[model samples]
Target: MGGEGENTAVDLTAGDPADVENDNDRIITEEFKIWKKNTPFLYDIVMSHSLEWPSLTVQWLPDVSSLPDKDYETHKLILGTHTEQNEQNYLMIATVNLPKEDTEIDARKYDDERDEVGGFGGVDNKIEISVKLNHEGEVNRARYMPQNPFVIATKGPHADVCVFDVSRHPSVPANNTVRPEHRCTGHTKEGFGLAWNPHKEGGLLSGSEDMVVCYWDLKEAGKTVAATRQWKGHTAIVSDVAWHCSKPTLFGSVGDDKQLLIWDLDEAKDAPVFAVPNAHEREINCLAFAPHSEFLLATGSNDRTVALWDMRNLSQKLHSLEGHRGDVFQVQWCPLDETVLASCSSDRRVHVWDMARIGEEQDEEDREDGPPELLFIHGGHTARVEDFSWNPNMERTIASVSMDNVLQVWQVADNVFNEGNEDEEEPADDDLE
Candidate 1:
């Protein structure tokens, strides 16, 4: 079945060592002649770039607390060119000066901890490092890459955090570089979520696709491995997990079974705080808590609806805002504004909804068909909107990632980061996916 050209003439395109060496010899001779003719200038230019290759993109994260009178740095983009690569995925943290101007919203007060070794990096697997951006906003760089990084969750130094790494290899694929790095038995299934405990020292929680949520303690040994307690309830795949910002004892998970299960990290109990079956009509793709409200939660689904629920009053639907005809992939509430919720859908639309205005105008005219009107429908992605994040440090800044391999930063309005009292505005009708 071999082609006739494969064994015959010198294949210039093939990567054979003999052929490549010959080609390099010929090119080197021609380059040497040109370099001799160019003289001193060629030597200087050739010696200039001896360090590293040029990167595709460069960016700086914004400082937030330095901004005047902002309670939370929701307007600042703390992560610069924050990319999550499939092969070498890393949470890169960088530090730089903020733009200086009168209207300049640079909050550099938190720049003292610009030290590395706090961000996460891993090769060939979804190994999330539980590192945080220091005050100066830099990542933790090591001489050699760390190993057995299963699920990382940050706590005070000494021994703090958890992470999961590839423990087994199935078969060598076309991409030979992506082989599994290790073989170990830690969790029952692959880890899906990691969160640091805000109240306790070296306390954290990790969830796996195995439908188990484990409480971990890393206060003993540096980079330790162990679980104190495990909580189980769901019979399906657990997709995501998150700790309640204020409630350290409680955490949440959304899964493939289209259910939302709330787990209490405290070992005093063996069951969930609350289990809501049929939470989403479809698979729950993403879930986020209201950064400012403890009783409020948001969930996105493949059903194209972003549901807002009030733990206080769940007798009926609080607000089921449906605009995207495709799956609503991810959702997050503004850290500074509990009423502002952002959702990215497979329909390629990133919508920002003002939950404070939900059912606020439920008159006979407006409630004829749908719920509250859309606050803003963000556009730009040429393909499905995979993920988007609102900067926790700046004002009204949002960054989104798409399947087109592009990331976009959009400023919604001038210092209007918390539009709690603004009138709801309906965007123009445009059917684009």
Candidate 2:
């Protein structure tokens, strides 16, 4: 070592890389134990389930049920597999039971009943496969029809998509091939983007590497046909498409060409009404229109950052969020809070951003961190977070899936999101000292 800070960097050339990796694993394992031990203090309701195979996408269903007289509630979720084995791959509806309240088994006291990785789920609350239908291709993404939750749309590796009426399948879990209710075929190459119109019934949108976004009108009952319209607005791969929450004819798409195009079907079918070129520094992986505010949108990029935009004025970004070390995979606005947003990344973290907190004062420790609007960073996953979904029925709750075969559901601890959690109330002007 040299004097002062001259040789502060560790000499990595001297040690065996395998030993270093093992040490890192040991540290991570122990850190997980501590994180699980403090679960009660970190979440309103948290549960982690290790899956048999990795799922690439997840969405919460509208259905919720409870066992006879039991205080536990079971929530339905739709997820799809990405396995190479065609027989093993499926679009499935799974159920996870929740307690009447937060977990009662304190890990600090009764840590004996824990799994090898430190999860505390038992038989009552364990995840169960409710229905699984054979899928012909890898499910890159999946979404349920807003008006018809039983109907699910899945995007494949190519310009292929399968629509399944899950209600027609067996209610119980089984491994068997099931034909799709309909198929939407368009495009000439691969793509992993899919979206169902929230404002229009039987309306769907699919985008692929062919650089065209196709619209499907699935109102023919049992018969399915090719795309009714193809919007060629991008010169590269269309990564995603999102429908405006209230505007049936209005939608937006992001692509590899670094453009965010807003399409108005009422005006034109082939060209966008508004386009924001170079919306992100790199390929825009995903985009989401604010659930409550129609003019606000958020996008995540390959540049490892998330950007907030006002659709009314795209001259410049409203905010550029930087925290993730890997590419931002997806960005979504919380339905319960118009100003709140969430982004997941390949860096194995999910960040919760509160736009309302921007420009607010912060303590010394928070000032040393990144942005004041950074509400919380969730680092519970061990691998790259593939996808995540917010629970519309629950406040501040979200579920995420990772590459390492883990599905976790958690809600932020109230003190972090609730302003009433302040330790002491400031007196009004009349009562001020």
Candidate 3:
């Protein structure tokens, strides 16, 4: 894996040989089959896109209405770059257009055989829409509004949070007429993390190096932007923040101070409802609240460990997962499954975990020392993976961005594990010998 400081040229259209089944594909295919045979799930690399610059964040837009008379949906991806070159920090919106005829054929094939190998082939054609922001700062994070697909929010090594309106010019080559619609400046230092309130129409939250969190209401537009409320609690820089999916007034933040703080808008503005000090041995990098459970939370740290917590019991952690050889950068829960989650790390691997199996194991104190139960490990990136996103509408599909300047999309194969096979025994040693 390469360091973050390495600079690379823009190569947006080049495709990886492994993405489509080339010479190196045989090894990957065999390994994938073996892994799927032993595990309960399977995955395949469906698409790969090269970038001109390294990206620290990638986000998938919400599902949109299909084009008129077309049976396939048009999906879009937003990539935020991190670079030292002047004006190299850009935001790109890549649209994947699948032909209806090819999609129908693939669907029919999958329905007939239902094999792990059969599905729509990798996407070879896509349209790229890009824009250069006014500030030449590293983009640490980017996210789309829950209610509006056209609106996006980004923050980085700048004091202000930038908002872009993609509808201004859907097809890019942006001119002076199309620019960032708003710049919300309140933080005294560079911003690190950002999250949109899932339940609020125009509410947003941002964490910064200034050790403060600011809340903004974008519902009202004006010449200048200001935070509706701001709070300070952490003694160190805040690394990430996330809003609860079902609770509009609740949110969480993790920081370099090794603390996880939970805030509520309806309560006192100055203090948090629950503060878990020393959440990890090292700086906490990122966190996400479970989509299905309001009390469940997950956090990753520089200590190379991920911990799951129950908000109802702040004193004890539900589980501590350790497998990544390097720092854990991001963790996300599957939108469709309550017991599944995924994580990316500086070790250049993406791992998927099944909490149902983990819950059946003995507690950390009683169990012997060994790696946690990991369902799958994706070793496709040549460099450290910085961020990844799960598709909201698709089951077992995910997209990840890496410092190698590549974007890869992976999807789990259907019916890899046969029903009622959990009780089967392995072959005898004499048979293998």
Best by lDDT: 2
Q: Across residues 1-433, which tens digit of lDDT does each residue of candidate 3 receive?
A: 0111111223323477555345334443444344334222233224556777888998888864466655556677778778765554666677655334335323222121222222444433543544444334777888989889778888877788888876774454544342578888789988668999988877989999999999989988664589888989899998899999889999999999999999998886579999999999999989999999989999999999989999999887888888676799999998877888988999777877767767455557323323435655665566789999987766677789999788877665433211125664433223211
Candidate 2 residue-wise lDDT, 209-262, digit = tens: 899998898877454568888999898999999898888999999999999999
Cα deviation at 239, candidate 1, in Å, is: 1.3
Candidate 1 residues lying further than 4 Å off, grouped into runs, are 1-89, 94-101, 104-186, 313-316, 360-373, 415-433
Q: State the C-alpha lDDT per candidate.
A: 0.48, 0.77, 0.72
199 Cα displacement, candidate 2 (Å): 1.4
Best by TM-score: 2
| TM-score, candidate number 2 | 0.87
Tens-place lDDT per residue, model 1, 1-433, is: 0000011123356698897978855644454343223222111111000102111121223333344542222222212122233222222222222222233322211112321111111111111111222211111111111122222232111122223222232212233232222112235755334455656655656555677666656555343465777677767766566667678677788877888877776547687777788987888867777778888888888888988777666444477888775798778787656678888877656787776666565667445333564665554444566666665554454666555544545445331223343673322223110
* Candidate 3 residue pairs that clash: 10-52
Ranking by lDDT: 2, 3, 1
lDDT of 2: 0.77
| CA displacement after TM-score superposition, residue 299 of candidate 2 (Å) | 0.4
Model 3 lDDT on a 0 to 1 scale:
0.72
- Cα error of candidate 1 at position 194, Å: 3.0
